[model samples]
Target: MGAMVYWVILSLSILALGVWVFWSVRGVRAYVRARGKRLVTCPETHCAAAVELDAKGASWKAFRGGNYFRLQDCSRWPERQDCAQDCLQEIETLGQGCLVRTIVAGWYSGKTCVYCRKPLDKVEEWTGHMPALLDPDQKTVMWGEVPPEKLPGVFENYKPVCWSCHIAETFRRVHPELVTDRPPRW
Candidate 1:
Protein backbone atom coordinates (compact mmCIF):
# COMPACT_ATOMS: atom_id res chain seq x y z
CA MET A 1 0.00 0.00 0.00
CA GLY A 2 2.86 2.39 0.74
CA ALA A 3 4.57 1.72 -2.70
CA MET A 4 1.29 2.16 -4.58
CA VAL A 5 0.61 5.52 -2.94
CA TYR A 6 4.14 6.75 -3.79
CA TRP A 7 3.72 5.84 -7.48
CA VAL A 8 0.36 7.64 -7.70
CA ILE A 9 1.88 10.79 -6.20
CA LEU A 10 4.74 10.74 -8.71
CA SER A 11 2.32 10.34 -11.64
CA LEU A 12 0.22 13.28 -10.49
CA SER A 13 3.31 15.46 -10.18
CA ILE A 14 4.37 14.60 -13.77
CA LEU A 15 0.90 15.43 -15.09
CA ALA A 16 0.99 18.79 -13.35
CA LEU A 17 4.38 19.52 -14.91
CA GLY A 18 3.02 18.69 -18.35
CA VAL A 19 0.09 21.06 -17.93
CA TRP A 20 2.37 23.87 -16.85
CA VAL A 21 4.65 23.34 -19.86
CA PHE A 22 1.72 23.46 -22.24
CA TRP A 23 0.37 26.69 -20.87
CA SER A 24 3.79 28.39 -20.81
CA VAL A 25 4.50 27.49 -24.43
CA ARG A 26 1.10 28.77 -25.49
CA GLY A 27 1.77 32.10 -23.76
CA VAL A 28 5.20 32.50 -25.37
CA ARG A 29 3.84 31.87 -28.85
CA ALA A 30 1.17 34.49 -28.29
CA TYR A 31 3.80 37.03 -27.21
CA VAL A 32 6.00 36.48 -30.26
CA ARG A 33 3.08 36.71 -32.70
CA ALA A 34 1.74 39.91 -31.16
CA ARG A 35 5.10 41.74 -30.76
CA GLY A 36 5.58 43.98 -33.77
CA LYS A 37 4.81 47.34 -35.31
CA ARG A 38 1.25 47.12 -36.56
CA LEU A 39 -0.48 49.49 -38.93
CA VAL A 40 -4.14 50.16 -38.18
CA THR A 41 -6.66 52.78 -39.14
CA CYS A 42 -7.74 54.82 -36.13
CA PRO A 43 -11.48 54.36 -35.82
CA GLU A 44 -11.75 57.69 -34.01
CA THR A 45 -9.96 59.78 -36.66
CA HIS A 46 -10.53 57.43 -39.59
CA CYS A 47 -6.85 57.74 -40.61
CA ALA A 48 -3.84 55.47 -40.78
CA ALA A 49 -1.79 55.10 -37.61
CA ALA A 50 1.20 53.08 -36.46
CA VAL A 51 0.67 51.17 -33.22
CA GLU A 52 2.44 48.56 -31.13
CA LEU A 53 0.80 46.01 -28.86
CA ASP A 54 1.33 45.46 -25.16
CA ALA A 55 2.74 42.03 -25.87
CA LYS A 56 3.84 41.30 -22.31
CA GLY A 57 0.34 41.85 -21.00
CA ALA A 58 -1.20 39.80 -23.78
CA SER A 59 1.15 36.88 -23.11
CA TRP A 60 0.32 36.90 -19.41
CA LYS A 61 -3.38 36.92 -20.20
CA ALA A 62 -2.90 34.06 -22.69
CA PHE A 63 -1.85 31.74 -19.86
CA ARG A 64 -5.43 32.00 -18.60
CA GLY A 65 -6.86 31.32 -22.10
CA GLY A 66 -7.64 34.96 -22.64
CA ASN A 67 -6.29 37.13 -25.48
CA TYR A 68 -6.42 40.60 -24.03
CA PHE A 69 -4.45 43.38 -25.78
CA ARG A 70 -3.88 47.09 -25.37
CA LEU A 71 -1.76 49.78 -26.96
CA GLN A 72 1.86 50.04 -25.94
CA ASP A 73 2.65 52.89 -28.30
CA CYS A 74 0.93 54.86 -31.04
CA SER A 75 1.79 57.57 -33.57
CA ARG A 76 -1.26 59.61 -32.58
CA TRP A 77 -0.18 59.88 -28.98
CA PRO A 78 0.32 62.97 -26.75
CA GLU A 79 -2.80 64.42 -28.38
CA ARG A 80 -5.32 61.62 -28.87
CA GLN A 81 -3.81 58.67 -27.07
CA ASP A 82 -6.24 58.94 -24.14
CA CYS A 83 -9.07 58.25 -26.58
CA ALA A 84 -10.54 54.75 -26.58
CA GLN A 85 -8.38 52.28 -28.48
CA ASP A 86 -10.93 51.16 -31.01
CA CYS A 87 -8.00 50.29 -33.32
CA LEU A 88 -7.28 47.09 -31.40
CA GLN A 89 -10.44 45.60 -32.89
CA GLU A 90 -8.89 46.02 -36.35
CA ILE A 91 -5.71 44.32 -35.17
CA GLU A 92 -7.61 41.44 -33.55
CA THR A 93 -9.47 40.88 -36.80
CA LEU A 94 -6.63 41.41 -39.27
CA GLY A 95 -3.82 39.71 -37.30
CA GLN A 96 -0.70 39.49 -39.48
CA GLY A 97 -2.36 41.36 -42.33
CA CYS A 98 -1.97 44.62 -40.39
CA LEU A 99 1.75 44.16 -39.78
CA VAL A 100 4.05 46.67 -41.48
CA ARG A 101 6.25 43.89 -42.80
CA THR A 102 3.28 42.24 -44.46
CA ILE A 103 2.14 45.52 -45.98
CA VAL A 104 5.64 46.27 -47.38
CA ALA A 105 6.09 42.73 -48.65
CA GLY A 106 2.79 42.96 -50.52
CA TRP A 107 3.88 46.26 -52.07
CA TYR A 108 7.20 44.81 -53.27
CA SER A 109 5.67 41.69 -54.78
CA GLY A 110 5.68 41.55 -58.61
CA LYS A 111 7.45 44.91 -58.80
CA THR A 112 10.46 45.84 -60.95
CA CYS A 113 13.17 48.37 -60.19
CA VAL A 114 12.36 51.75 -61.68
CA TYR A 115 16.06 52.31 -62.50
CA CYS A 116 17.55 48.99 -63.71
CA ARG A 117 14.24 47.26 -64.56
CA LYS A 118 15.29 44.24 -62.50
CA PRO A 119 12.42 42.29 -60.95
CA LEU A 120 12.33 42.68 -57.15
CA ASP A 121 12.44 39.54 -55.05
CA LYS A 122 11.32 39.08 -51.45
CA VAL A 123 12.27 42.00 -49.19
CA GLU A 124 14.67 40.39 -46.76
CA GLU A 125 13.81 42.20 -43.58
CA TRP A 126 16.12 40.04 -41.47
CA THR A 127 18.92 39.33 -43.99
CA GLY A 128 19.88 42.99 -44.59
CA HIS A 129 19.10 42.62 -48.30
CA MET A 130 16.25 45.06 -48.80
CA PRO A 131 15.08 47.05 -51.81
CA ALA A 132 14.51 50.80 -51.96
CA LEU A 133 11.82 53.20 -53.04
CA LEU A 134 12.12 55.90 -55.70
CA ASP A 135 10.44 59.12 -54.74
CA PRO A 136 8.62 61.37 -57.21
CA ASP A 137 11.64 63.66 -57.44
CA GLN A 138 13.89 60.71 -58.46
CA LYS A 139 15.48 60.41 -55.03
CA THR A 140 16.42 56.89 -53.95
CA VAL A 141 15.57 55.85 -50.39
CA MET A 142 15.58 52.64 -48.48
CA TRP A 143 12.60 51.42 -46.46
CA GLY A 144 14.51 52.03 -43.22
CA GLU A 145 14.96 55.64 -44.25
CA VAL A 146 11.22 56.12 -43.99
CA PRO A 147 9.71 56.47 -40.51
CA PRO A 148 7.05 53.99 -39.43
CA GLU A 149 4.42 56.72 -39.21
CA LYS A 150 5.04 57.72 -42.84
CA LEU A 151 4.98 54.19 -44.29
CA PRO A 152 1.44 54.40 -45.58
CA GLY A 153 2.10 57.62 -47.45
CA VAL A 154 5.43 56.38 -48.78
CA PHE A 155 3.86 53.21 -50.12
CA GLU A 156 1.28 55.21 -52.00
CA ASN A 157 3.72 57.67 -53.61
CA TYR A 158 7.06 55.85 -53.99
CA LYS A 159 8.09 53.29 -56.63
CA PRO A 160 10.11 50.15 -55.88
CA VAL A 161 13.82 49.85 -56.80
CA CYS A 162 15.96 46.74 -56.53
CA TRP A 163 18.92 46.88 -54.18
CA SER A 164 21.52 46.91 -56.95
CA CYS A 165 19.95 49.91 -58.65
CA HIS A 166 19.50 51.70 -55.36
CA ILE A 167 23.20 51.36 -54.60
CA ALA A 168 24.28 52.44 -58.09
CA GLU A 169 21.85 55.35 -58.25
CA THR A 170 22.83 56.52 -54.80
CA PHE A 171 26.52 56.47 -55.71
CA ARG A 172 25.88 58.32 -58.96
CA ARG A 173 23.66 60.87 -57.33
CA VAL A 174 26.22 61.51 -54.62
CA HIS A 175 29.27 61.60 -56.92
CA PRO A 176 28.09 62.50 -60.39
CA GLU A 177 31.64 63.14 -61.68
CA LEU A 178 32.77 59.58 -60.89
CA VAL A 179 29.90 57.91 -62.73
CA THR A 180 29.75 58.24 -66.52
CA ASP A 181 26.29 57.56 -67.93
CA ARG A 182 26.67 55.05 -70.75
CA PRO A 183 23.96 53.95 -73.16
CA PRO A 184 22.91 50.28 -72.96
CA ARG A 185 25.20 48.04 -74.99
CA TRP A 186 22.15 46.05 -76.09
Candidate 2:
Protein backbone atom coordinates (compact mmCIF):
# COMPACT_ATOMS: atom_id res chain seq x y z
CA MET A 1 0.00 0.00 0.00
CA GLY A 2 2.86 2.42 0.86
CA ALA A 3 4.68 1.66 -2.38
CA MET A 4 1.49 2.26 -4.41
CA VAL A 5 0.88 5.66 -2.74
CA TYR A 6 4.48 6.83 -3.42
CA TRP A 7 4.25 5.77 -7.09
CA VAL A 8 0.97 7.67 -7.55
CA ILE A 9 2.41 10.87 -6.05
CA LEU A 10 5.52 10.68 -8.27
CA SER A 11 3.41 10.12 -11.39
CA LEU A 12 1.18 13.15 -10.61
CA SER A 13 4.22 15.39 -10.06
CA ILE A 14 5.76 14.34 -13.36
CA LEU A 15 2.52 15.02 -15.21
CA ALA A 16 2.22 18.51 -13.72
CA LEU A 17 5.79 19.33 -14.70
CA GLY A 18 5.20 18.14 -18.24
CA VAL A 19 2.11 20.32 -18.58
CA TRP A 20 3.98 23.41 -17.31
CA VAL A 21 6.79 22.87 -19.77
CA PHE A 22 4.38 22.48 -22.67
CA TRP A 23 2.50 25.69 -21.76
CA SER A 24 5.71 27.72 -21.41
CA VAL A 25 7.04 26.57 -24.75
CA ARG A 26 3.79 27.42 -26.48
CA GLY A 27 3.72 30.95 -25.05
CA VAL A 28 7.29 31.64 -26.18
CA ARG A 29 6.60 30.30 -29.65
CA ALA A 30 3.53 32.52 -30.01
CA TYR A 31 5.44 35.65 -28.97
CA VAL A 32 8.27 34.91 -31.40
CA ARG A 33 5.87 34.36 -34.26
CA ALA A 34 4.11 37.67 -33.57
CA ARG A 35 7.28 39.74 -33.25
CA GLY A 36 9.66 38.04 -35.70
CA LYS A 37 10.44 39.64 -39.04
CA ARG A 38 9.07 38.03 -42.13
CA LEU A 39 11.42 36.87 -44.86
CA VAL A 40 11.07 38.58 -48.23
CA THR A 41 12.92 38.84 -51.54
CA CYS A 42 14.04 42.30 -52.62
CA PRO A 43 12.23 43.23 -55.80
CA GLU A 44 15.13 45.34 -57.06
CA THR A 45 17.81 42.70 -57.37
CA HIS A 46 16.08 39.52 -56.15
CA CYS A 47 18.15 39.51 -52.93
CA ALA A 48 16.63 37.71 -49.96
CA ALA A 49 16.16 39.53 -46.64
CA ALA A 50 13.95 39.86 -43.58
CA VAL A 51 11.54 42.81 -43.52
CA GLU A 52 9.22 44.29 -40.90
CA LEU A 53 6.46 46.81 -41.31
CA ASP A 54 6.35 49.89 -39.11
CA ALA A 55 3.29 51.10 -37.21
CA LYS A 56 2.33 53.51 -40.01
CA GLY A 57 2.27 50.67 -42.55
CA ALA A 58 3.72 53.13 -45.08
CA SER A 59 7.29 52.50 -43.96
CA TRP A 60 9.25 49.28 -43.59
CA LYS A 61 12.73 48.18 -42.68
CA ALA A 62 14.67 45.34 -44.25
CA PHE A 63 17.31 43.46 -42.27
CA ARG A 64 20.33 42.49 -44.30
CA GLY A 65 23.93 41.75 -43.39
CA GLY A 66 23.09 42.45 -39.70
CA ASN A 67 21.96 45.99 -40.53
CA TYR A 68 18.51 47.47 -41.02
CA PHE A 69 17.70 49.66 -44.01
CA ARG A 70 14.63 51.86 -44.19
CA LEU A 71 12.48 51.12 -47.20
CA GLN A 72 9.09 52.55 -48.05
CA ASP A 73 6.05 50.38 -48.67
CA CYS A 74 6.85 50.44 -52.39
CA SER A 75 10.28 49.00 -51.52
CA ARG A 76 12.13 52.15 -52.58
CA TRP A 77 14.79 54.01 -50.65
CA PRO A 78 13.58 56.46 -48.00
CA GLU A 79 13.57 60.18 -48.87
CA ARG A 80 13.44 63.27 -46.72
CA GLN A 81 10.30 65.39 -46.61
CA ASP A 82 10.16 69.04 -47.70
CA CYS A 83 12.55 71.39 -45.92
CA ALA A 84 9.73 73.59 -44.60
CA GLN A 85 7.98 70.73 -42.84
CA ASP A 86 8.11 71.02 -39.01
CA CYS A 87 10.06 68.94 -36.45
CA LEU A 88 10.46 65.98 -38.79
CA GLN A 89 12.00 68.15 -41.48
CA GLU A 90 14.35 69.89 -39.06
CA ILE A 91 15.55 66.53 -37.83
CA GLU A 92 16.12 65.39 -41.39
CA THR A 93 18.06 68.54 -42.14
CA LEU A 94 20.20 68.01 -39.05
CA GLY A 95 20.70 64.36 -39.90
CA GLN A 96 23.94 65.14 -41.73
CA GLY A 97 25.44 66.38 -38.47
CA CYS A 98 24.06 63.66 -36.19
CA LEU A 99 26.47 60.81 -35.48
CA VAL A 100 23.70 58.39 -34.54
CA ARG A 101 22.40 57.44 -37.98
CA THR A 102 20.00 54.74 -36.76
CA ILE A 103 18.11 57.04 -34.37
CA VAL A 104 18.01 59.89 -36.88
CA ALA A 105 16.18 57.68 -39.33
CA GLY A 106 13.73 56.38 -36.76
CA TRP A 107 10.27 57.90 -36.13
CA TYR A 108 9.62 60.74 -33.61
CA SER A 109 13.31 61.64 -33.43
CA GLY A 110 12.78 65.02 -35.08
CA LYS A 111 9.37 66.18 -33.83
CA THR A 112 9.49 69.49 -31.96
CA CYS A 113 7.24 71.66 -29.85
CA VAL A 114 4.74 73.48 -32.06
CA TYR A 115 4.89 76.78 -30.16
CA CYS A 116 8.56 77.26 -29.32
CA ARG A 117 9.72 75.33 -32.40
CA LYS A 118 12.35 73.73 -30.18
CA PRO A 119 13.47 70.17 -30.72
CA LEU A 120 11.88 67.49 -28.55
CA ASP A 121 15.14 67.34 -26.58
CA LYS A 122 14.13 70.30 -24.34
CA VAL A 123 10.80 68.79 -23.27
CA GLU A 124 11.87 68.50 -19.64
CA GLU A 125 12.28 72.26 -19.22
CA TRP A 126 8.56 73.14 -18.95
CA THR A 127 6.53 70.49 -17.20
CA GLY A 128 4.39 70.49 -13.98
CA HIS A 129 3.79 74.27 -13.97
CA MET A 130 0.45 76.00 -14.09
CA PRO A 131 -0.51 77.46 -17.44
CA ALA A 132 -1.14 81.24 -17.42
CA LEU A 133 -4.89 80.82 -18.02
CA LEU A 134 -5.15 78.60 -14.97
CA ASP A 135 -3.58 81.29 -12.80
CA PRO A 136 -6.44 83.74 -13.44
CA ASP A 137 -9.09 81.08 -12.91
CA GLN A 138 -7.42 79.33 -10.01
CA LYS A 139 -10.44 79.62 -7.72
CA THR A 140 -12.79 78.07 -10.32
CA VAL A 141 -10.35 75.54 -11.76
CA MET A 142 -11.30 72.11 -10.46
CA TRP A 143 -7.82 70.60 -10.68
CA GLY A 144 -5.47 72.37 -8.30
CA GLU A 145 -2.33 71.16 -10.01
CA VAL A 146 -1.55 69.99 -13.52
CA PRO A 147 -1.10 66.23 -13.49
CA PRO A 148 2.42 65.03 -14.29
CA GLU A 149 1.18 62.43 -16.74
CA LYS A 150 -0.27 65.10 -19.06
CA LEU A 151 2.99 67.06 -19.15
CA PRO A 152 4.93 64.99 -21.69
CA GLY A 153 2.74 65.56 -24.74
CA VAL A 154 1.96 69.16 -23.79
CA PHE A 155 5.61 70.03 -23.26
CA GLU A 156 6.66 68.17 -26.36
CA ASN A 157 4.47 70.34 -28.60
CA TYR A 158 4.00 73.55 -26.68
CA LYS A 159 6.75 74.33 -24.20
CA PRO A 160 8.52 77.69 -23.48
CA VAL A 161 5.27 79.53 -24.17
CA CYS A 162 3.69 81.51 -21.35
CA TRP A 163 0.40 80.03 -20.10
CA SER A 164 -1.59 82.15 -22.57
CA CYS A 165 0.41 80.99 -25.58
CA HIS A 166 0.00 77.37 -24.62
CA ILE A 167 -3.78 77.73 -24.32
CA ALA A 168 -4.05 79.67 -27.58
CA GLU A 169 -1.95 77.21 -29.51
CA THR A 170 -3.76 74.22 -28.10
CA PHE A 171 -7.13 75.72 -28.91
CA ARG A 172 -6.00 76.66 -32.40
CA ARG A 173 -4.83 73.18 -33.14
CA VAL A 174 -7.68 71.28 -31.52
CA HIS A 175 -10.49 73.61 -32.55
CA PRO A 176 -9.48 75.66 -35.57
CA GLU A 177 -13.07 76.15 -36.70
CA LEU A 178 -14.18 77.54 -33.37
CA VAL A 179 -11.24 79.91 -32.87
CA THR A 180 -11.64 82.18 -35.86
CA ASP A 181 -10.11 85.14 -34.03
CA ARG A 182 -6.62 84.94 -32.61
CA PRO A 183 -6.44 85.72 -28.91
CA PRO A 184 -5.42 89.39 -28.57
CA ARG A 185 -3.88 88.68 -25.17
CA TRP A 186 -0.85 86.97 -26.64
Candidate 3:
Protein backbone atom coordinates (compact mmCIF):
# COMPACT_ATOMS: atom_id res chain seq x y z
CA MET A 1 0.00 0.00 0.00
CA GLY A 2 2.86 2.41 0.86
CA ALA A 3 4.58 1.68 -2.48
CA MET A 4 1.40 2.59 -4.37
CA VAL A 5 1.06 5.80 -2.42
CA TYR A 6 4.61 6.81 -3.23
CA TRP A 7 4.07 6.13 -6.92
CA VAL A 8 0.90 8.22 -6.97
CA ILE A 9 2.68 11.08 -5.23
CA LEU A 10 5.53 10.93 -7.74
CA SER A 11 3.09 11.04 -10.67
CA LEU A 12 1.27 14.03 -9.17
CA SER A 13 4.55 15.83 -8.63
CA ILE A 14 5.54 15.25 -12.26
CA LEU A 15 2.17 16.54 -13.46
CA ALA A 16 2.48 19.64 -11.29
CA LEU A 17 5.99 20.29 -12.62
CA GLY A 18 4.78 19.98 -16.21
CA VAL A 19 1.96 22.44 -15.60
CA TRP A 20 4.33 24.91 -13.96
CA VAL A 21 6.73 24.70 -16.89
CA PHE A 22 3.92 25.26 -19.37
CA TRP A 23 2.69 28.32 -17.51
CA SER A 24 6.17 29.76 -17.21
CA VAL A 25 6.82 29.27 -20.90
CA ARG A 26 3.51 30.90 -21.76
CA GLY A 27 4.40 33.90 -19.64
CA VAL A 28 7.80 34.20 -21.35
CA ARG A 29 6.19 34.03 -24.77
CA ALA A 30 3.81 36.79 -23.81
CA TYR A 31 6.70 38.91 -22.62
CA VAL A 32 8.70 38.41 -25.83
CA ARG A 33 5.66 39.21 -27.96
CA ALA A 34 5.19 42.42 -26.04
CA ARG A 35 8.83 43.53 -26.09
CA GLY A 36 9.91 42.38 -29.57
CA LYS A 37 9.75 44.78 -32.49
CA ARG A 38 9.00 43.10 -35.83
CA LEU A 39 8.10 44.07 -39.35
CA VAL A 40 4.61 42.77 -40.00
CA THR A 41 2.73 42.56 -43.31
CA CYS A 42 -0.88 43.58 -43.72
CA PRO A 43 -2.79 40.83 -45.51
CA GLU A 44 -5.65 42.99 -46.76
CA THR A 45 -3.53 45.59 -48.58
CA HIS A 46 -0.36 43.52 -48.87
CA CYS A 47 1.52 46.36 -47.28
CA ALA A 48 4.44 45.95 -44.91
CA ALA A 49 4.88 47.93 -41.71
CA ALA A 50 7.14 48.12 -38.71
CA VAL A 51 5.15 47.39 -35.60
CA GLU A 52 6.27 48.74 -32.27
CA LEU A 53 4.97 46.76 -29.35
CA ASP A 54 4.26 47.94 -25.89
CA ALA A 55 4.97 44.82 -23.93
CA LYS A 56 2.87 46.13 -21.06
CA GLY A 57 -0.14 47.03 -23.24
CA ALA A 58 -3.31 44.96 -23.15
CA SER A 59 -3.25 44.02 -26.85
CA TRP A 60 0.08 42.21 -26.98
CA LYS A 61 0.07 38.51 -27.89
CA ALA A 62 2.52 35.69 -27.28
CA PHE A 63 4.53 34.80 -30.35
CA ARG A 64 4.58 31.11 -31.37
CA GLY A 65 8.03 30.86 -29.85
CA GLY A 66 8.67 31.98 -26.34
CA ASN A 67 11.66 33.88 -27.71
CA TYR A 68 9.59 36.68 -29.25
CA PHE A 69 6.23 38.50 -29.13
CA ARG A 70 3.82 40.21 -31.57
CA LEU A 71 0.93 42.62 -31.56
CA GLN A 72 -2.59 41.23 -31.70
CA ASP A 73 -4.08 43.95 -33.93
CA CYS A 74 -1.09 44.97 -36.02
CA SER A 75 -3.18 46.70 -38.68
CA ARG A 76 -5.11 48.79 -36.22
CA TRP A 77 -1.81 50.11 -34.87
CA PRO A 78 -1.16 53.61 -36.20
CA GLU A 79 0.22 53.63 -39.74
CA ARG A 80 2.35 56.77 -39.38
CA GLN A 81 4.36 55.22 -36.56
CA ASP A 82 4.45 51.82 -38.23
CA CYS A 83 8.03 51.80 -39.43
CA ALA A 84 7.85 48.02 -39.70
CA GLN A 85 7.14 48.14 -43.43
CA ASP A 86 10.25 50.11 -44.25
CA CYS A 87 12.24 48.01 -41.82
CA LEU A 88 11.09 44.79 -43.42
CA GLN A 89 11.75 46.03 -46.93
CA GLU A 90 15.23 47.06 -45.99
CA ILE A 91 15.84 43.72 -44.30
CA GLU A 92 14.65 41.82 -47.35
CA THR A 93 16.76 43.91 -49.70
CA LEU A 94 19.95 44.24 -47.68
CA GLY A 95 19.99 41.20 -45.42
CA GLN A 96 21.06 41.24 -41.74
CA GLY A 97 24.61 42.63 -41.96
CA CYS A 98 23.83 45.58 -44.20
CA LEU A 99 23.51 48.17 -41.48
CA VAL A 100 26.59 46.99 -39.64
CA ARG A 101 28.68 47.16 -42.78
CA THR A 102 27.44 50.63 -43.64
CA ILE A 103 28.30 51.90 -40.19
CA VAL A 104 31.76 50.37 -40.23
CA ALA A 105 32.49 51.73 -43.70
CA GLY A 106 31.35 55.20 -42.78
CA TRP A 107 33.61 55.18 -39.75
CA TYR A 108 36.59 53.99 -41.76
CA SER A 109 36.02 56.18 -44.80
CA GLY A 110 37.96 59.30 -43.75
CA LYS A 111 35.59 59.97 -40.90
CA THR A 112 38.12 61.21 -38.37
CA CYS A 113 38.19 59.35 -35.12
CA VAL A 114 35.84 60.94 -32.62
CA TYR A 115 38.82 61.56 -30.30
CA CYS A 116 41.86 62.36 -32.48
CA ARG A 117 40.42 63.04 -35.92
CA LYS A 118 43.15 60.74 -37.26
CA PRO A 119 42.39 58.66 -40.33
CA LEU A 120 41.83 55.03 -39.42
CA ASP A 121 44.18 52.56 -41.10
CA LYS A 122 43.33 49.22 -42.67
CA VAL A 123 42.99 46.33 -40.18
CA GLU A 124 45.84 44.24 -41.65
CA GLU A 125 48.49 46.68 -40.38
CA TRP A 126 47.26 46.83 -36.78
CA THR A 127 46.25 43.28 -35.93
CA GLY A 128 48.56 41.37 -38.32
CA HIS A 129 45.46 39.18 -38.67
CA MET A 130 43.64 39.06 -41.98
CA PRO A 131 40.16 39.60 -40.56
CA ALA A 132 39.82 42.53 -38.19
CA LEU A 133 36.59 41.80 -36.45
CA LEU A 134 34.08 38.99 -36.65
CA ASP A 135 30.34 38.86 -36.29
CA PRO A 136 29.84 37.39 -32.83
CA ASP A 137 26.82 35.30 -33.76
CA GLN A 138 27.53 34.46 -37.42
CA LYS A 139 31.20 33.58 -36.80
CA THR A 140 31.99 35.30 -40.10
CA VAL A 141 35.01 37.57 -40.24
CA MET A 142 33.74 40.97 -41.30
CA TRP A 143 37.02 42.29 -42.65
CA GLY A 144 38.88 39.27 -44.06
CA GLU A 145 37.73 36.04 -45.65
CA VAL A 146 34.70 37.82 -47.18
CA PRO A 147 34.39 37.19 -50.90
CA PRO A 148 33.41 40.05 -53.19
CA GLU A 149 30.41 38.16 -54.58
CA LYS A 150 29.18 37.23 -51.11
CA LEU A 151 29.56 40.75 -49.76
CA PRO A 152 26.19 41.99 -48.55
CA GLY A 153 25.43 45.63 -49.26
CA VAL A 154 28.40 47.82 -48.23
CA PHE A 155 30.34 45.13 -46.37
CA GLU A 156 32.75 44.81 -49.28
CA ASN A 157 33.97 48.29 -48.42
CA TYR A 158 34.93 47.32 -44.88
CA LYS A 159 38.51 48.18 -43.82
CA PRO A 160 40.49 47.00 -40.85
CA VAL A 161 41.90 49.47 -38.33
CA CYS A 162 44.60 49.30 -35.68
CA TRP A 163 43.50 48.31 -32.20
CA SER A 164 44.44 51.72 -30.84
CA CYS A 165 42.11 53.52 -33.21
CA HIS A 166 39.28 51.09 -32.62
CA ILE A 167 39.60 51.26 -28.85
CA ALA A 168 39.93 55.04 -28.85
CA GLU A 169 36.95 55.46 -31.10
CA THR A 170 34.88 53.17 -28.93
CA PHE A 171 35.87 55.07 -25.83
CA ARG A 172 35.22 58.45 -27.45
CA ARG A 173 31.72 57.39 -28.39
CA VAL A 174 30.98 56.68 -24.75
CA HIS A 175 33.18 59.27 -23.06
CA PRO A 176 34.44 61.93 -25.37
CA GLU A 177 38.03 63.09 -24.66
CA LEU A 178 38.67 60.03 -22.51
CA VAL A 179 41.23 58.50 -24.89
CA THR A 180 42.45 61.64 -26.71
CA ASP A 181 45.38 62.15 -24.34
CA ARG A 182 46.70 58.65 -25.03
CA PRO A 183 49.09 58.33 -27.96
CA PRO A 184 47.99 56.18 -30.90
CA ARG A 185 49.85 52.86 -30.63
CA TRP A 186 49.22 49.82 -32.77
lDDT to native, each model: 0.86, 0.37, 0.45
Cα lDDT of model 1 by residue, 82-127, tens digit: 9799998899899999998888888888888887787776555426
Model 2 spans with C-alpha error above 4 angstroms: 6-10, 26-30, 33-39, 43-186
Q: How many clashes does the backbone of model 2 have?
A: 1
Cα RMSD to the true fold for all candidates? 2.6, 15.0, 12.0
Residue 78 displacement (Å), model 3: 11
Candidate 2 lDDT, 1-186, residue by residue in tens: 999999999999999999877655655443332232233434343443233323122111111112222322222223322222222223234433321212222322455433455454332433553322122322212122433223333333432333445566667767878877756685
TM-score of each: 0.83, 0.24, 0.29
The sequence of per-residue lDDT tens digits that candidate 3 reaches over residues 1-186 is 999999999999999999877766776655543443334444445554334444544222332323332243343455544534334444445433333333444446553433344555453443452223323332223343443223333344433444455554446657875545657689
Error in Å for residue 2 of model 2: 5.7
Backbone clashes per model, in order?
Answer: 0, 1, 12
- Indicate the worst ten consecutive residues by lDDT in candidate 1: 120-129
Ranking by TM-score: 1, 3, 2
The TM-score measured for candidate 1 stands at: 0.83
